[model samples]
Target: MIVERLIIADNQPLTAYAVEALSRSVAQEIHIEDLEIAYAQNKTQLNNLLRDGKKTAVVVDYTMFDFTNQENFTIVCDLYQNTSCWLLLSEELTPNFLRYVVYQTQNVGVAYKDASLDSMREALHYVMTGVRYISQQATQILLQKAAEAENRRDELTHTEREILKAIALGKTTKEIAADRFSSVHTINSHRKNIFRKLGVNCVHDAIKYALRAGLVDESEFFI
Candidate 1:
């Protein structure tokens, strides 16, 4: 795959310089031409650079950029179908941010700003080839979050799990009580316990947990 333009959308001078150098090395190895540093301070500039619809690879640090949120960055990425991104993350980035962006788009490659030169090169190569790459540090964050979520699911009792699933399936407390041959108060008590055990305050949070834990399928939720 040929990369028509390489855009470095970072503000940090040191890291941006490193990224540019590494990008140049990779570009030479892969024969990518027209490499230029397009410092897109905001979404508009970034959009203008990618307006031509050529196959462009963007190396960006979204945290430093003017994007309001990760979703906004994703919106820009989605707008440019021919553009791929390499997210140069900071050490302070949260796992939720990583999870949201990585899952929300497939054309993004993730690596830390402080990542090794080799890893950054690999990430750029993957992005240029239209393949997703998650650096070792980012992969650990995702894995750890998944494990913590799994452990939280394990804290729920079997009965609480059933009640959680029922709630996620949109069953009312009265309906669950009737189905289980129990009183409404009893069902309500189960709901409270389910929320407490899941460390959630509202039914919505519990439902999200249920969905993530595979306690209920998304289609079943709609049905």
Candidate 2:
């Protein structure tokens, strides 16, 4: 798909010029509006610009702090519904935060500001096709998000959660039952359910699951 117009929005002067140059080959085809400030910083300006421009893809710096991740995402989502968003990321951004961004928008691309122009081109090329483009670091962040989501899916019921934590604390079934005023048989049943839900077989495996799921502290492993 051809990008009818490319809007380069950045607070940095030199970076904006460089982006204009990089997009020259494509920009020459129709129009490429280079903004001297962060568009996400000024919603009114962005809205007005888009209202008059042709079908466009916004290449912007993701460094503006005034808007939150969700807010930024709302803008991205709104743009993606009609156009596209190509983001220039910041080194200071955490991987978890990036995962939240990925969760918000699908047809988007992002690269660190310090990345080479080739990297930027690669990102732009894919996002122009309505594909998700991201760096290796961003990939790792997405993987971490996936792993965390899996842990959540394996989450325990309230009673099962308590039993899981108690096991992580090195408590035996009989001891846990006494602590909770439950019978040994009831405790054993909960343990069995926990194992089945977590897809683990033994107490040790269950403890590991609890630790990964953040149901217990790492120090509890030694206890």
- Which residue pairs show backbone clashes in model 1? none
Q: Evaluate model 2: give its lDDT.
A: 0.65
| Per-prediction TM-score | 0.77, 0.56
lDDT of each: 0.77, 0.65
Q: Please write out the lDDT profile of model 2 over residues 139-180, one tens digit for every residue.
A: 876677557545654466898998889989988889999999
RMSD value for candidate 2: 10.8
Best by TM-score: 1
Which residue window of length 10 is worst by lDDT in model 1?
A: 82-91
